[model samples]
Target: MASFSEREQAFENKFKHDAELRFKIIMRRNKLVGLWAAGLLGHTGDKAEEYAKSAVESDFEKPGHDDVIAKLMADFQAAKQEMSEHRLLKQMEEMLDEAQRQITAE
Candidate 1:
């Protein structure tokens, strides 16, 4: 029984609320993920925070907001990629060390 303007107002309120909630979720999830990733990568607290910020900034939204969300997701992926690279480098170092030890033993 709501008029068109009333329906529009209701949607605006819901949209605002949903956006705020989504941002909070993004920030919290990004912080947790970044913390774990940073620990594995040996990043300092400041660097970890920066990484988390980028991650939170980069996330997907609903179809109407895909442009903004897509950009943010790209940023999140980049941070994750950086962390992945760090882990890979550490693993490579361990492998190289083992190889060197085996060669010396022979």
Candidate 2:
């Protein structure tokens, strides 16, 4: 019984750590996408980092990337920047991969 309890606790700890890592990856991915978008929109330096932070915050509106997509689409249109939805989605996917690698390395 004690051994079983210890195993269960270990599993719980691992689950929590994995969940935190996943969240960090998502946030990093968002920031990466934001930095890319900022470059396309002619923002640089501190402005670009601020835009990246906004991208991370945009995810809070809903579960999944819908909110981030909508925000990016609106921003692009407003800034008169030409960006296809397909391209944006692809960038996000690439960033996600990079983020996972970065988090795993850490």
The candidate scoring highest on TM-score is 2
Candidate 2's residue-wise lDDT over 20-105, tens digit each?
A: 99999999999999999999999999999999999999999999998999999899999998888999999999999999999899
Estimate the TM-score of every prediction. 0.42, 0.96
Ten consecutive residues with minimal summed lDDT in candidate 1? 60-69
Off by over 4 Å in 1: 1-4, 57-106
> Where is model 2 poorest over a 10-residue stretch in terms of lDDT?
79-88
lDDT, model 2, position 55: 97
Q: What are the per-residue Cα lDDT tens digits for candidate 1 across 1-106?
A: 4698899999999999878765554445445554555555566779977765654454444443233334434544765644344453454345445544544464
Deviation from truth (RMSD, Å), model 1: 16.6
